[model samples]
Target: MKKIIIIIITLVLFGSCKKDEPAPIVVPIITSINPIQGNPDTEIAINGSGFSTVVSENIVKFNGVVAKVSSATSSTLIAKVPISSGSGLVEVSTSKGSANGPSFTYIPDIFVGGIESNGSKFVGKYWKNGVAVNVTNGTNNVTIYSIAVSGNDVYLAGYETVGSVKVAKYWKNGIENILSDQSKDAFCYSIAIDGTDVYVAGSEFNGNQYVAKYWKNGISVSLTNGQVSAEAHGIAISDGNVYVTGQEALPAGPLVAKYWKNGIATSLTDGKYDASAWSIVVSGNDIYISGYEDNGVNYARYWKNGLTNALSYNGNNIVDQIDQIVVSGSDVYVAGRQSKTALYWKNGIAVPLTNGSNLSFAHSIFLYGSDIFVAGNEFNGTAKVGKYWKNGSAVNLTNGFFDCSPWGIIVR
Candidate 1:
């Protein structure tokens, strides 16, 4: 009996000495990613808790593309963006568990910029895949005429009217940068970003006439001599050369469609009719410009390398207007209005976007791979409706409760 009591005590003591099992590790939770978007080989840090301490045990993927991790800890991990990674949710996996972080938008996402009226005033806005980013309040009238995205920065060109003064400005990631003060009214009609340089083309009031001008990094360079009313409506950069297209108002004559290369003007039309150039694009050794001319008929046309081609339509007593132009590979595209309907042209063939029951207009065009996108507006019986068309399908950006219009679109 004494021996059995001693054995029971030994067993009890052994049981008491046994170690308690470790608590199960919490699942890995991802709180954020620094500099969420970048090209291949871009190092990004993932910040969160419950990460594996062993560097070799953590796995990171960007849209299914495996990322090479450099270091790991309980709350952080550093990884490089995998080559050929597209935009999608970023996931981090560990032995404990896996977690999803915020979506990292790949560079070259589709962006649209424009304005919307809210019964009282006009507010400027831009969108990244239908998510609205309001750039202004309705206190003053503002417009966003163009959009350009480079790296992780977004630039918008337009003007804001404060009382009687029109202010030319551009927005970089929603922060306004003023280009014109109250000295004279100004309008920024187009913007082009090359590396870190910002170029804007427009017109600023010069005493008795509006002078066509282009600004490089906010430094003004006049394209016309301010002797006549002129406007620079479109800008393009290629092969270390700057090209701007618009019209020069001839004294007591019609507006002439012309383009300037490095401040030298090239006439595209005879001074016999009112012609305007709205957009320009340079591809290889060719230059393409789109606009309209009133030669007894309002004809929508595009000029290619100083040649001309008219976009055809079959409507009686109707007018056509071309607002934007784009060129891809061997194809040329233009967005504008046909009669009272919004439409686009591919290689000079008209593709309608709306029925002719109300007034509509197409202002911008963007091509992605094999897909075509056009931003415009349609009058929905009661109000103006903003629209973005993919291929032939239309996506309305706003309900028909107020006036809204999209003027610029870019699909990187």
Candidate 2:
């Protein structure tokens, strides 16, 4: 009787111990992810169960590439979207198991500036998210060289041939505003806006020479004395100060790279070699200009507050030019062409966007978050087509059947 009672008690104890043991490990279950869509580097919150408390052990991926996990808990995680990610499912992996969340989409708005032919003449136009809006009425040959967007307003600067002269003009939301009188030939190459004031920079013929000039709210300010030929190719405004960049043609001398701050001329290079400033931008108090200088050969260069930085090419006699510039945070980006190949430089490091099989040009660059966008044209065997590249992947704005060129870009 004592043995039977002892055996029964032992069996009851063993049954209790078995009942107290934990169940099998449960795999993570991802219910959802906040902000189902965003650009690259966008931070997202993941809600799931059975995640690792240690963030490094918790693996998050957007389309198989590992994402950067900032923080992780047993049931929550914060991860930054990877730069190489596109529209795909977000997956979370832990030691327990892996689970997939909802799909994440990455889409960004893009604007491109260029010209389109209307049978007989080229008409100035710009595309917003792949839809084209006409800047001109196709009455005359119009060329749009630059574009700027502020809030809901759109501005395009270029020239329209009127009679025998090219009249400097800019369009504000499809309405034309003349910057120069029809008495002399003029052209506007760049446009900028500050608050309520509109600024247009270009060249005007004054019967004697082409004068580098900028118009602020329709008031003209000449950077040159009209005796020497000069042209303004880019304009920027910061803290009530106006900046314009171009080249001044001295009498019988090479073109000089120059910039004007509030109508005060500053020479970036002497008139010994041919140099031109095609783009200008101001970040904080630092000024940057992009162009090319002829050091026996045309070499791509940019000046940061008057200090020169040169870009490298493949070989001798290869021409390079920087056509546009933008400063975001502490990074400086310049877009241009090197020996007919499209490229952009980030802080003086060249990133080629195209192979040298055909002619390609990168005319404008814009950075939205961690995404880099370049707008320009690429020759598709038969004709040049307007297109933009998002992180080196090309998106055509125009069909390859027609010739088009993109000169400027902006992303908001």
Candidate 3:
């Protein structure tokens, strides 16, 4: 009788402890979530109290989108942001109850494209905020010079080596679309997109000389004759009008910087100085173009409505190689190399992206909301490090192992 009574008492004590385990973890009290804003699939830690230690016991939702809780503890839970999740409050559900946390903002995805070398031949690829996706085969030489995002599709313009010639092509969502045949060598420099229409600006060799042209939905339209060598470096579409910027070589051997508005060319610089327009932007009724003019040496200058103005830094006109030009709310932004250091100029004030620690160059500038993004690369004396800047904050995209050159960027 005594042995039976002792065993019964032990069983009652163990059952009581099992019921107490779930009672202590009441409704979760969320203290905070680190990094209030992040892109989709980004891993974020939720710091709080009353969370169950078992991962299956805690459920996290970002704006009603369920997130996978990889791990959990009494005070914290690591959850991944669900794909396609919008901005809203974060909620955590447990067996005890549900708790509402701080609002989680979603950062729109950033897209950038360039070339990365793997010891031997260079191949083309792009990055969505550091996650790389290969667009070209590694056996041949391929390069992506420009990239644009439209809705859910991504378009890239560049060239690929086939036999003895370089063929101009564009990739729509990583699928290749050839723009030029193998009759002559060709090169693609820029790409732009407007609802259902894909435009690519490039140069093609037509027996005698390179012709400035652009392709609309894979159909070619020549902007210049085959008389002189000319190449379209940048393209933009505004208010149903197509604007192409390039340099037309004169008979006297001087290159004249010009832009063609619906096939009608307007010269921005005389043929006396060797100049080329690298980028063009149209805002409202204002037209802006950025490039360099070589008088004695190369000097960065931008033309606003056919009037030339130098890029200013510290109240003085700065000199360097400018690559991309952008206009946001009456402010002009330019990205390039200043004294071998990568920098971007906002309304003529030079904002250096690097501390001159290593050789760097800023090639593309993009504006998102109130944030400024610049894409470029830096040479650290050992390897080329792919980098991009957001509002003057540096973000390394590569691990400095292979060479990376990012020439274009777009954030949406």
Q: What is the TM-score of each candidate against the true structure?
A: 0.78, 0.74, 0.76
Models, CA RMSD each: 8.4, 9.6, 9.3
Q: Residues 59-101, candidate 2: write the lDDT tens digits.
A: 8999787899999888889998875466789899888889988
* Candidate 2 runs further than 4 Å off: 1-107, 315-317
Query: Per-residue alpha-carbon lDDT of model 3 for 111-189, expressed as tens digits?
Result: 8899889878778889997899888878878888899987568788999988789999999888999999887999999
Candidate ranking under TM-score, highest first, comes to 1, 3, 2
Give the alpha carbon lDDT tens digit for every residue of 256-335 in model 1.
Answer: 99999999999998989989888999999999999877887547889999888887666522346788999998899999
Model 1 C-alpha RMSD to native: 8.4
For model 1 the local lDDT of residue 151 reads 60
lDDT (Cα atoms) of all candidates against the true structure:
0.87, 0.87, 0.89
lDDT ranking of the models: 3, 1, 2
lDDT of 3 at 308: 83
Q: Give the TM-score of candidate 1.
A: 0.78
Best by TM-score: 1
* Candidate 3 residue spans exceeding 4 A from truth: 1-104, 312-318
